[model samples]
Target: MTATPHLNTEHPKHNLTGFIIFLCSESVIFLAFFSGFALLKTAALNWLPPGVEGLEWRTPLLNTVVLISSSGTIWLAERCMSKGNLMGFRAFWLLTMALGAYFLYGQAVEWSGLQFGFTSGVFGGTFYLLTGFHGLHVATGVFLMGLMLVKSFIPQNYAGGEQGVQATSLFWHFVDVIWIILFVLLYVWQRS
Candidate 1:
């Protein structure tokens, strides 16, 4: 008689822990860039490059609103998922992805109108490095959410995928939080 091997069906805690650690590492990278920008701003007499005036506020502010709103939508999606409401989860998840996409589009449009390039100087280099890195994260979050949404269509997948949804939500929230800081630093603080 052959013995059957036991499989652990419970959700593993290490997956979430590993993801948190990864986020912490990412946080350190962002902090380094922020610190560099602050140091440069304080040391330099001319913060903005020669031809550039100051960053325009309107579009970026609107983008910030959209990106921040995504945090709420993703939260609702996670809540719905925990309660086993798949339809509600799908709706909110879709909304979150849409908001992320809109923010990315707004950022690209703003970049297109900029007077300076990444090679301009310290301000330009830091500005593109910070925003571009954050934008990459935003794009990643959106892509992950897209995969999650597709997997959600299968009923069996829904029950097994809660951890994935939570991880994606956490990542999305991190992206949103980072954007809030970047918006204040790049747009608001530079002006004053």
Candidate 2:
């Protein structure tokens, strides 16, 4: 019999580099949207549609705090996973998911109370487009975290699933960072 060829057994512990490239591509799309918003803000004489004063910051600021806190909780989960603390990982991971869900709920409440719709004008269109897109990403992150939590129940997955864990954490962190930028653009800067 011919000798078997040696197999490559070495593999990366995580696909962080690939994931980062993916995030970069996502950043391009968000950058385009933000650029469009800035252009409209500068060119339009009346940034707020007639009769619309401006957005209230209270609810959104609270939601921002909740969403930003998720980044910390997720980071803690990653730290726990790296240290072989599965229980800690699960606890923090679940907490992160809860925070994301709360943010989504808060967004929904705010959207419901809005006096405008997508067809209202440029202000309304951009507002819904940006926040809705970001909200979708947050929902996706929560769903992924739920899957990871279910997988964590399996001991085999816990021992050898660092790549998935790391990728999810990276995605969650990227979403949080994007929200920060969006919050500044849509809420703080526009109001000013």
Candidate 3:
């Protein structure tokens, strides 16, 4: 006789669906800003504007490396969780958080060195608005990861599937992808 395994308590599948809906809504918000920025850039006499000749691109590029690397670290962390290696999971996850913090710090340092104000012109305004919103998202992602990190230490909290880690990973990857687009538009294309 073949033995059939009994089902455990049903883990909610709706969490993934809810997160997808949230992502779609957030996509609309980003799309609006992107479209507006494109329109404004085309209409303006000068996209760079006065007092903002060139952004110090090197620092942001390095920060981009750090931020993008966090995505990889988080992926490894998830892998660790799947393998039931809590120590490996925590180490990689904490490394991801630290990289995120470094990226934010680099952004602050770059902004401090810049000569333009928010009111400088359209370029300055859009620059800050777009990047600022993205930064806010990164911050939120980091905070969420921090909470997950704390919960992970609890034996019960991590016994189930890594739903929280998965969600945070998706969000963090999205944030990093957005930054790549912004970096190209704001730094690379603008330079040319």
Candidate 4:
């Protein structure tokens, strides 16, 4: 007779702790980017990105609101999931997805206003490098959230959707926080 291996069926297979820790490491990466952004901005020579002209205020302000609101909606989604409220989770995730789309759309509008494209100069280089990286983060957040939204509709006995929900929330919130730091450093501080 051959010996058989046993499965640990007593616990959930999803690893929330590991996912949260991964998010924390990503937070540190954004922190370093913020520090570099602060230094480069303050040390600028003759002109800023648009040549002595600085970044716009109104658009970024609107984008900030969009991203922050999405974070809030995602938080609400997580709460709903914890309570086993599938309807609430689906509604919240849908709203969050819409807001995420809006934020990216807002960024595209702002990019259109940028006088210099990627080839402009130092300002173009640094501005695009940092903000573009952040935009990628936002895109990932949307994709992950969308995945969770789809998972919500599946039959019972699903185990990992909650983990995805929390991870996406952490990532979306991180994106919002990073933009706050970037906007302050790149636009506001450069002027005054």
Q: Highest TM-score, which number?
A: 1
Superposed Cα deviation of residue 59, candidate 1 (Å): 0.3
lDDT of 1 by residue, 33-90 (tens): 9988998888998888887888999999999999989999999999998998999999
The sequence of per-residue lDDT tens digits that candidate 2 reaches over residues 48-152 is 887888999999999999988999999999999999999999999999999999999999999999999999889999999999999999999999999989989
Clashes of each: 0, 0, 0, 0
lDDT of 3 by residue, 43-103 (tens): 7777776655777789999999999999999999999989989999999999999999898
Please rank every candidate by TM-score, starting with the best: 1, 3, 2, 4
TM-score of 1: 0.92
Better of 2 and 4 by lDDT: 2
Flag the better candidate by lDDT, 3 or 4.
3
- Tell me each candidate's RMSD, in Å, in order: 3.4, 3.7, 6.3, 3.6
Candidate 2 has its poorest 10 consecutive residues by lDDT at 5-14
Q: After superposition, how far is residue 111 of candidate 2 from its true place, in Å?
A: 0.1
- When summed lDDT is taken over every stretch of 10 residues in candidate 1, the lowest stretch is 1-10
